[model samples]
Target chain A: MNEAAASLVADDGVPLKLKLRRAERAHKLKSVAMIAPLFLFLLLSFVLPIGTLMYRSVDNPELHRALPQTVAALAGWDTQALPDEPVFAALVRDLRKAQEESTLGLASRRLNYEISGFSSLLTKLVRKLPPEGAGVRDAVIAVDERWGQLTYWRAIARAGTPLTSFYLLKAVDHRVNEAGDIESVPANEAAYVTVFGRTFWIALIVTLWALALGFPVAYLLATLPSGPSNLLMILVLLPFWTSLLVRTAAWIVLLQSGGILNGAMIGLGLIAEPLQLVFNRFGVYVAMVHILLPFMILPLYSVMKGISPAYVRAAVSLGAHPFLAFWRVYVPQTIAGVAAGCLLVFILAIGYYITPALVGGPDDQMVSYFVAFFTNRTINWGMASALGTLLLIATLVLYAVYGKLASSDANKARR
Target chain B: MQPYATPIERVWFYAFRVICGLVLLYLVLPILVIVPLSFNSSSFLTYPLSGFSMRWYEEFFGSHEWMMALKNSLIVAPSATVLATCFGTLAAVGLTRGEFPGKALVMAILISPMVVPIVIVAVGLYFFFADIGLLNTYAGLILAHAALGVPFVIITVTATLQGYNTNLSRAAASLGAPPLTVFFKVVLPLILPGVVSGALFAFATSFDEVVVTLFLASPTQRTLPQQMFGGIRENISPTIACVATIMIVLSVLMLLTMEWLRRRNEKLRGAG
Candidate 1:
């Protein structure tokens, strides 16, 4: 060894710094290179957008800015009784200023888009602003007529903020009562808890449907000769080659009232009239199962393919019935595949929005529908974010439970 | 250990075979119907062939919107493929070969795109891109599509690398070759097939994605699937059949290419 190498090395000839530095550099480079694309992608698409979406929850500029005078006046008021004249005078001043600056229209439009009746309230209040600002609170109350009502006071008090918790509260089936205290919404108007329940139920139904249809086909493919089995496997995978849109659309076309399914049933004389299949729960289930069946079959079939025939043969030789042998020996081996397929289908089904939107009845809509509703219609980012956060939590919990089950199953197998 | 060939067993076996065949046929029927309908001379999208012609294909080529969407998809899919392939291959190697704390958590984060609802991802991206003034730009779409594509590439490539040997790289490193040099010259050629297949998967994924594209892009920048979505919403157009037909053809070609590469890769691995 060279003198420098010998000096750097231990008596056993370890080149400490060079080896460590080289290893360090390699490891760092590998990690950076490996993770860079994912980081860039998430940063641009996933992270940035999610950040913006979450930020939109507290975003209140048009309202707070236009009504700054009114908001500032009402900031520290006690909630024991209705507001006094000064708060009304602040509203009149803010409304007049807002009208002059053309900011009132934008603020009211934004609010109306969120909750529906705010436009007329703002418009009427602005138009009837007294020549000398007299009866400011009563005049403000006179515009909507609801302003004098206790409910109106409650709404104003609830929404009386530069930043409102209204959307977030509504997302979880709770809201600020007239007293400005948070409470559960009435059972009739409570939407989210039921929506979440429906989401879980629909996903469960779809998972079971796919498994029911897929297991037999998967077993047949597993038992077939290699040549035919491979071809069949490709056939099973064929639907995946088409766009998901096309598959969903095809189902719509086939299931509609005047569509092929109705035509077929009528021709067969099985029904006197066409069934109302499309735009209903039955259509949603059918479409989801068709789309997700291949996912179930492919994994289950692959797992089943790896099982040795000898195990079943040995079981039969030991005097087990064929049915028992198939169940005890063959079926146990497919647990991994079944787990994977169920997990895959269930997760995909839970996130489904399009098929359900197109085919499901109004009540059949999942939690994602409301998430979109808040975003597109209400423009209520806080509610949308809260809903999304809830969904994320549910998904993570499901995954954790799945992981625990899978690991315990693995442990049981080892035992 | 064959079962007794009783009449009931034989009958049940035949019934099972017939049912399975019918299911397979059912699965492929809609896809198979698209090509024939694409050739329908009649403008209506129905079977029984009013006539046979290439008019739909001609129309697809003639229309500016269809062609523009096609152009957008062509541009976006390749860029996404390149991005996904690089990152996915790197991740596959690191995940399989490298040791680190929180490795499982990192891997989960990397694959979470696949698990999360597309609507959530899309709306989140919509708000995000709007915030950054990138809502309609090619850079935004490419990055969004690439993020969606990465999970598939990572999944396929990692599966491919599962059985690969680590000793060869260690041996090359022990002979005084730099790690980078060894990687490019030795490791790359060995894993090139996995890398290529991953790219194919990435390409297919981005090309087929619709939800995120819809929310993140405008009419002028809409992808083909988004275009088809608009067409379906706006009116009943036979051109949708032509579009679906073309997508099917391209996907079949791509699937064939991947399968061929897989076979060739196996042969090459065997020879090596």
Candidate 2:
């Protein structure tokens, strides 16, 4: 040991540890070189884009950019009352400039998200600007009654900053009020909170339905011999591999009012009239459950396959009822799979867009539907980013929980 | 499992099997219904078929729009599959074989595209691509699709690498074989099944994807699912059923190939 320690020093008098590290550095660099191309690709394609979208949730630069002079003039005036004549004059100047630059719609549409009437109000004021010598405040107030209200000025002042929480607040159906406090919007104007609630409620119901239906099949697959189980496993996997759009299309064919289910029931004399099935909540739930059932089953079957049947037999030999024995001895062992599957199904369902959009009615749309609506239909990128951020957060949380559950299961098995 | 079973146990067993059978039927019924309906003479997607006909399939083949979308999908899916397989296989090898700091964080970031909601991804890519003038272009759509497909490739390839023996590569290196030759001759042959399956998954993902394409693609660049989405939204006809039936057959084939590859992988490992 003494000779080895003495020989550890190199001929040049460097220590062995540092020499080893210098040698190991090449291997480390090679590994990093292998991973760097993909890392850079994903960073450019995936991570940066999501970062840009999240930034849009707080981005309120258009209003500030278009109304620079108005924002500057309003800075000194307390928002306690209506803005003075100079502020109104500055607004007139910005409006005329914005109109000439073909940016009036963009500026006003941004403010319109804050207050309901600002869109038309700004457009109307732009269209009906008084003759060259006229007073700006009266001209604006005369164009629209909303310009006389303090609430409109407050929303504008709040949105004057480069970054604002207006869209995020509105995403949860809340808004900044005249008194500069956060509060809920009027009951009728409130839409997002209800949609979010419906998204979660539908997701929960679908998760439950998948669990209910998947449990029996998973149990059957676990208990059966290898041959039949493998065949049945293919049935589950085939649906899992099938195109999502195809499955949704199938549901539409079979569940529409004049479709197969109704026709079959009428043929069998179960009902005289065709039932309203598709284009409603029922259709959404039915299709979502069908699409997500495989997600529920695969985890559950793997877990159940690991559980020994001797435990149930031991319970039954102890004079417990058979159902009680199975439930008490076997079911608890599958809870990890249940948690993983339910969380996965719920996460996927809440963000579902294609199924509900095809099969659902007006009232059946979820939060993701609104996200798409604002993105494509209305071009309200702020609201879309805000809603998308919220959904992303919820999904990430649930996914973290699933990760823990899955890892712990793996750890337990290894032990 | 059937040790001294009571009548209640027997009933429960049969009932459970029946429920499982029904559930399986539910899983398969949707894909099955589209096949016959696509051939129906009537345009409606309902029962009581007028007669068997191939008009819808003809229409699908004849239409410029559908053919264009099909062409676009074929182009995008294969390109995305190849890109994803290359990047994902390299990263999986690096991760499994190399010791590194922050390895877990790297894996998490690589797989996160699969976890994040597609709508979020679509919206993000729309805004980002629009800023860079990549929107409405095939390059943008293919990049986005490739990003989405990478996670599947990484997952499968990493799983395959778990059973791989590292000493074989070391032995080859000691014998004066170059690194590339060792990889092609020893490691690649062993992991080829995993790579192929992963590529299959990437292809299927790109083929079935609609949301990102909707955000990124122009009307001229629409893929099959985007076309189907528009068709389903604007009109309901047996033409969509025809397209859907074709997709079902494709999925079945893909599933069988995956199963076959998995069995081959297991056999190779057992023999080795």
Candidate 3:
């Protein structure tokens, strides 16, 4: 057959293949056109902001923006010793600009991250700076003697880099020592590692507890007849549907020192006095588990519901023990649900800010608390972004695992 | 019924039911506990019912702060819900209908708001909104909330669209109706329940969102949850319980509405 004649033609004698390609392109364009509005809206309102956050973690703009001339001038200076006249002159010029621009505190605030008292040192240096003069270095040193130290100049140099790992390093409880190698801070200052540890630890405990409590309830819902199961399902769903603030508020009311639960216990003479329930680890666990149990149960119930009872019945009829048969034949079918539910609960638990803030004690605060602390109280954007990036990493990694399990489960169902 | 033959089996059966019952009790009890506490007449939130009164509810409704919060919630939740429903439904339809490159990545990004730590979002938006002068404005809060609400609408609407048959629309189109008419007449009627459900979800999301409001809202724009957060944090009062009860009732009503829609959807599918 002739190649030209082999292809079919449309009614207008155009090649059908080209026509089909044109039609497909039009369809895609239509779809994209429809999606563009929402996509752009999200990009501007949500995704861009998140991107800004991730960037802020390592952005290092404060030092770079405040002292552009000093940062540029220090690029050629070796870390071994003090700088020469031009570098001091650039510092003077940068400080004058910062003073006039009202950004003197920024460079100093950044240096303070490296050394404790550097903030006030830089502030005083700026405040007491006489008019631009020949001996700017000596004048600055006279204002604050610490400014003459090489260590402080090294901090300025380290922060003056366009992108600094200072915040990220600090987040893991490590610091760049005077020798320029990463090392753990002294034991007393090493707080973030413990905080991260506690975050994951709390999340794990809550996930396991939720699974322990939710599995049986999910099993009952799966095994019961439709009439009873539907009624029982409301108990799970009503709480799930309720506002989180309301649920957390209710827990506060129930567990406060003079609250109903403690009062009830006292009235019944269950204990000599009211328990220290709220604002502690015990309260955190109870509220978190209560908040997250539905996530675990709903997934587990969906998975258990699909499993046929016949498998277990047949195993028992064939002389296998009922419990063993249930475990062997039935339990395996629900792993997908268990994995999804546990991971979901763990993920949510780690990101928890509101519930823990309300119910947990000072020691019970997690990484999210520090993130908010840095953002709100301290105005430490770098620190906030660094901790947030870690959480974003954990969430994405776990979400990837969950995505795998869910898709594989779908595949199993397809078969 | 004959499944249990051994004595251990019978014993395990009762024990399992009792355990499940307790779990259910644990799930539902906290929500119910506040209902009575809200009605308690005592100034201090104690037990044994100091006697029922509507004083707390009266205070909640009568306070200017609570009333303003309620007004703000009404304004924000509805506007955000409308925006989320329109955009999310359109996007979900497009996502389901058309083939696209990087569809999965796009989807993941769209829903990432629900996954990312809200604190990070708050910080990022805090700076961003400040830059654009959206900080402390009702528009800023509403826009942020709408973004948060979009994922729910997309998830639900995409689900409904997946279960849809394209043949009905094809028939409508072949009968000489325009594209918009086919959509409004054939496609929308089938998906209206889903849209409504998604709207309810989006509404609830906006209504409940506090972290974003904490960063974004000025005192003039304080929301119900923000006000409650302050109340719970600064001072413990039954008025907070009263607010919680109202929120609980609202959510229960939403849940019932969702259930009704689910049944109706099933009936529609069955009839079809």
Candidate 4:
């Protein structure tokens, strides 16, 4: 014991624990060194950009920059009434400078998001600003009556700050009322909530469909002999390997009103008339289910493969009916796989854009379609970022659930 | 196979198999239908045997727009694949070898590109690239694509690394080999199959990606999938079928190579 104690001390009189900790620190440093390059790259390329986009969701800097003097003059004015003449003078100054620089278009567009007619109002006023010495307030009001309204001035003042929740509120079909309370927009104007609901509803139905179709196939693949099962596995893997656009295109060829499926049905005399299949909800569901089936089957198959046949055989021999035996003994064992597959399909379906955009009718489009519309067509980055943020949150929540389920399953395995 | 089964059990078993058969057909039929339709002589996309021809394939190869898109795809996919493979393999190695705080957070950040919707990524990247003057540039597209492809590489390579024996590297280190030397000589060869598979995945991802390209690519930088999207939206031509068929063939080849590599990896590990 005394010799062991002596060995615990290093030759230079340092303790062994300290020496070991130093070595451990060096190892950790080396690992950090190895990871640093990719870490920095992802930070620059992925994380930073997404962060910047999220910032854009609430970023309202254009009006602040373009109408700086007007923003300052409106700082302490009561929002219940129209601003005084100083605010109007500030507006004239900002507008004259903006017109000189030909930058009135940008500020006007930013203000247009707050009120409908502000864009035309600002553009026209900039074109017909009266002489510099006149009373700028009445002159501005004369150029456009919108300038005399409290709501328009309120919008300008609200937008003058560096950040605002206008876009984010608009994303969920809510708005800040003139009383500064959050309330829903008119029912006809509420688009995003319905789109989000449709996205989830379709994703849920697709997940259920995939589960229904995948379970039987996974069972067969798990139970069948190696040679045949492997062959069948390739059939599942082939579609999984194909290009997504190609697969979606194939669906178009098959499901079009004059396409092969209708042709075959007519030829077989099953129906006298062709059916409307493509460019609708039916087509969207069919295409999504076909595309996501492999995701479901693969997970279930892996889990089923690990389950021994002895459990079901024992259940059968114990006087249970065959169906009951299979369900009671076999199905419960594959819950982990079921959860994994369903979560994957559901998450993927909710974010799906291409299939729905191509195959579905106008009303059937998902939230992502609108996100893209705002981005590509309207160039409304704020609205697009807000919608994207909501989608991101939904995805992260589902992923967290999956992570929890997976960890619990692992814990169960350990037990 | 169980002798204990009742008479009804056999019926249930056959019924299950039939259902499975139909599911398999559902999965494979769409992909196979595109192949013969591509060769159909009729300009229409439907069946009824309008004879056979190679006109669509000829047109695909001859059209300047299609050819240019193809050339861009070829260039962009390979470049993105190389970049993703290098960074991903390095990250995978570090993650598997290291014991560090906040590892899970790092991993989540790295894989976030995969979890986030492509529309979001495309929009985010569009705004970012526009701000930095990378809009419509090859460098911008490649960087965005590589970011998208990195998660696949990380997943595949990390999976491969899980089966690797770290003792081999330690033994090399014990034999006076430097860390880099040990990595190159002992570690890389064993993981080459995984890295190659990851590269293939990265390539396929970049090749298939259209949303980001739609947002970022100018007219001159259009890709094949971008062109296909436009065609599908505006016109239903047989030429798209030809393109889809070619893509399927390429995917099949890639799948075969991946299967072979997987078997080879298993064999190598077993031999070791």
Candidate 5:
């Protein structure tokens, strides 16, 4: 062969390097072409909407949308005292325009979230305003003395912006005070911080319970002969494939006060009366653990199935205790599965809404319950989205961890 | 467990089996308890049936509301599954074949809907759909459900493509078959099981979806889960149990079908 031969060339006029580059470019283009329809569909349907949802947590557009001049009037004023007469004039003029547009409740209801009284205050002003716009500030003040107070104006000024952290702050049990410093709401008003804690608490309990129950079952499936193992595997997968609503409904029927569990317990004289099982935190734990146990078991079983039993046997043959050999040799190999399963079960558990709502009492509600409450019961989009954003953060962070573990586990397997 | 283990070790083995048996019982009990309750003659959801009867089953089949929900579910799940399979199969092939920057990022975006809480996705879609006047429309529900189903298709098809032999398609192309023809003729037959299972998964996703429907659907567009949700919220009825029993049977059938397909797929690959 020629030691320093000229670079190879394609049959085409182009050099080989450029030809390879063109081929690579074509490959990328083909893939992108295939992915385009789905990518665009998801972009419009899933990605964009969630982006808008995250934006909605800090969004307070109703006041700004309906009362633009009033917001502009308060642009220069700090959160100190009331603004000058011009700002009041701007408020009254904006109020009439909002009324004429039939959007008074839009501005007033948003302002009411910031401070509790402005809904009625502004709602009263639209009807009491003069036939004309002149002396409108006095006419508005005559309608409600509280509107004349700086507290009311501060509420307006704080919420008047197109973007505010009122909802996000409120989600964490903190709010922007009249002084405009971020402060915790009075203890009595604090609710969401507890709800967030309760969500995490419930998810953790479910994960632990699932782990305890699933480990032995997974071990049984992994170690047993094919005959018994297949039956056990079906037991796991059957519940897994069942409808989530059906399983939850089953729990409701079984755990209700006069339901089967109670009926059996009383028949056996296990307790004096039927216990409060469903519609409480106990039922939440029971149902969630039952639902998530398969997720826990499947991963652990897969990892355990790959591990050879010879290592444990080797330790036992070397005069080590059987329990010691099994624990030291076998358990370490399954940590990846354990972590994967626990995180997965935890992630799914935290976002549970239908099961908890169907079985849980008021006090047993998780953050998702409150998210639905704000969306459905109160029509408070800000509060709903803020809590949702928080839950999304929790899930995404855990998923990232899971992805890391999973990829590393796969890399190890490949090696 | 070793044959030469001490007495305690033998006891531990037996004890472990019992514990595992109890856990298996726990897993199946909730599912089984609903069956007899669905057939109870009385109106009460509690135990102690007055008599064995088919009244709840009759009510479930006879009700207009339940029939409408079942029809809506049927309409939505199949349409979404079709769209999801087409998009997902194409994307999976594209992803496996091409080298591109930010491929991981694209995959992450495609799968994000699966991780995000249903409540978040529901409200987000609600407000966004309202902007384009899609709320309460069947089209809106179907499109949203289809988006949710696509990731499953992508995942299953991509997994299937991983074990694929590329030389067959290359041979087809070399014989002057068009790329589309090679895909349809050479590759499609081999990967059909993956496509079918992915479609089944997508269908299941769309069928079981309720929270999104809660925000998007009106009374007219209510799905089966939403109907059950309303029933559970308002009152405990044996009819709900009857519906639950039917769904459980459906899942059992689906599981058996999946198991059969998996074995058949394995056998075909083994022969090849």
Candidate 6:
């Protein structure tokens, strides 16, 4: 080793490269320590819990432990036939085992939460079964009169697996039949499918309404002097900074029958009586659009501010009408901003819970309302987690599609 | 300030300007109305007040629950701001200066909090926090708020770092200063605008966040927004209007301070 390297090195005569390697190792250790806190925070707070919540979607403990014999016996039974005497006896055996194990109560509560009255059905049937005997079928049939029916057998067959597809199917308005194939629920019973549709419809309407209100203001912000523009922007952002609950509450007072809007209308002699505004879809839309309008304007204003004034001037000088020039030249450039703002607003509107729940009629409630219903009111985490997963997947897919469209447009712009 | 314009064009501009000014007034009317109504002697939250008084504000300030929520918020907001600023600055620095692989993925993950719907995030956090016994604790609430606040900090800091010059740090390093010392003495002072802006954004975001707080906080740890939420649900108090007025004033003051800081930073950057 050279003199300088030797001076830096240990008395063991380690090579210069080895010493450098050791120093690198020490540096990496220090870097890892620097990043450890953030990584640990994410793991403990975000990653682990999401992992567990997602897992609960398929966690079917009751089905696994309670009906083992019936599940095993059903493997041999003909799909077309009602379960025979042996299969019925096998079910009785399973119910007795489940009762003796004392774990079926939790399962019944969970199932009952999903489709009300399942707990009583399962409990009565389980209680009627003898400790061990041939008369078990007669006893269970006495408890649930529908026990011998094919529909009851089908429901049992549906719940046979520990790894359940139940929650996922319910999320999409389908479930397993007796033959173990997916089928839609009765048209009248289907709720979530319509709720998802309503979510998108409300989102689309809210996006359009916000755009209509925000576009003119954004134009002003772009055209005005810096002082006026900044002042106007603060007004726009003031509502955004305030608590959403406070703002929505204010809307309630403003929109209620005897509230400010009606009081003003009455005083001005515009209407004969107080109008029903709160607790309706109209109120929900008005409040949501008011709250979300800033999201649309901010991006649009920023984009408009960046466009050179000369381009519009250039169009005017070239025999193009002002409106035509504005639409053809100015609007196209702001497409990126419009797209971003629409996507942002639409995604937010779909997941709206507080505003809709507070102001809207029962029919105006969206998929997220049901997600919360399962989460809090019913305490059905499985269904809630499944619904959440469906929404997440839908959001991811929408983003992917948006990313594709954005890149394709960018490519065209380059060309 | 006068640029050449045709009479028709000038007319069009003024028409649009008046329409926009009206819209801005409409937007601010509710808040402006509430401030006066908060001082109304009458219990109702309506205009044409029954003489000026601050009884509602007095009532809000007197309540132990409201004061406790304000106290909790005072503790949580700054803690969240500090945590978010630190992690956000680290992530922003790592993304901007380091040529590591998967940089784009990491950056996307950092910014995803901004795009994701607060409802979904809150639901996810609710279940997640419950499992670890963090559902009601101040530490849990602060961490959740910090996580939510990080995106704003990242966006502001990244923008600031983009304007920063790396050559100053390189020069300091070449002059026998350690990398850490070079970062502190040279780089940080230069990008202090970004850091300050990021910290301000973090604080504002925490102060405003409600959905996650609704889900994650316990009765004892209830925030101001949560308290307002309960008031909206259970009572018809003009006190909520007072609370709203106070929050608006606080936010405006904070924003003005930040704007001042931003202007000073811009002037300093130009001079440097």
Clashes of each: 0, 0, 0, 0, 0, 0
Model 4 agreement with the true structure over B148-230: per-residue lDDT tens digits: 89988998999899898999999999999998999999999989999999999999999999998999999999999999999
Error of 5 at B176 (Å): 2.3
TM, every model: 0.88, 0.95, 0.97, 0.96, 0.96, 0.88
lDDT of 5 by residue, A1-415 (tens): 3332337677876667778788889888999999999999898889888888899999888988898888898989976666777777877778778777888776778878877777887777776765434565666677787867888887787888878889889999999886779999999999999999999999999999999999989988999997889777989998988888888888988988888899899999999898999898899889889989999999999999999999988998898887898789889988998999899899998998988888888888999888888989989999999999988999999988888888888999899
DockQ per candidate? 0.54, 0.79, 0.80, 0.76, 0.76, 0.44
**Number of backbone clashes in candidate 2:** 0
Pairs that collide in candidate 6 are none
Tens digits of lDDT, candidate 2, A1-415:
8568656977788977678778789878878888899999999889999998899999988877899999988887788879988888888888888888887677787787777678887877888986434477887888888889888888788888888888899899898777778999889989888888999999999999999999999989999899999899999999899999889888888988888999999999999999999999999999999999999999899889999989988998898988898788899989988998899899888889888999999999998888889999999899999999899989988887777777788898899
True contacts kept of each: 0.52, 0.78, 0.78, 0.68, 0.78, 0.35
Give candidate 1's whole-model lDDT.
0.77
Interface RMSD of each: 2.2, 1.1, 1.1, 1.0, 1.3, 2.6
Tens-digit lDDT string for candidate 3 (A1-415): 5566548898999987788889999989888887889999998889888788888888887778988888898999888989877777888888888889898776778888889898887777777765666887787777777778899888888888878788888889888888799998899998888999999999999999999999999989998999899899989999998999888988888888887788888888998788999999999999999999999999999999989889988998898887789889989988989999999999888999999999999999999999999999989989999998888898889888887788788898899
Give the per-residue Cα lDDT of candidate 4 at A369: 94
**Over the stretch A1-415, how does candidate 4's per-residue lDDT look in tens digits?**
7567547988899988779889989988877777788888777667777787899999988887788899989889889877888788888888898888877776789888878878988878888977665587788898888778888888887888888898999989999888789999999888898889999999999999999999999989998898899888889999998998899999989989889999999999999999999899999999999999999999999989999999988997898887898889999999999999999889888889988988889988998898899988898888999999899889989887887787788788789
Per-residue lDDT tens digits for candidate 5, residues B1-272, read 65777798789889999999999999999888788888889998877778999988888889999999999999888998898899989988999996789887898888777778888889899989999998899898989999999888998888888878999999999999999999999888888888888888888888888899999998999999889888877877999999989988988887787778778888988998
**Residue pairs with clashing backbones, model 5:** none
Candidate 2: misplaced stretches above 4 Å?
Answer: A1-16, A81-86, A127-149, B1-3
lDDT of each: 0.77, 0.89, 0.89, 0.89, 0.87, 0.78
The segments of candidate 3 whose C-alpha lies over 4 angstroms from its true place after superposition are A1-6, A130-133, A142-144
Q: Could you list the chain B TM-scores for each candidate? A: 0.94, 0.97, 0.97, 0.97, 0.96, 0.93
Give the per-residue lDDT of model 1 (tens digit) for B46-164: 54569888888889899998899999999998998888788777777778776666776777777778877887888888888787788888888898888888878787777777656
Residue-level lDDT tens digits of model 6 in A1-415 = 4777656756687776688878767755554454456555655655565566567777676665767777888876556667777777887777777778787876677556445677888877775665446666666677777776776666666566667888888888887765677899889767788888888899999999888778898888888889988888889988777667767887888888878899999999999999999889999998899889899898888878888888877997998988889999888888877887788788778878888978888999887788778888888878887877777667766665665565586687679
- Please give the ranking of all candidate structures by lDDT, highest first, separated by commas: 2, 4, 3, 5, 6, 1
Q: Write the per-residue lDDT of candidate 1 for residues A112-189, one digit (tens) a residue.
A: 634568678768777777543557667666666766655544455445465666666666788776666789988987
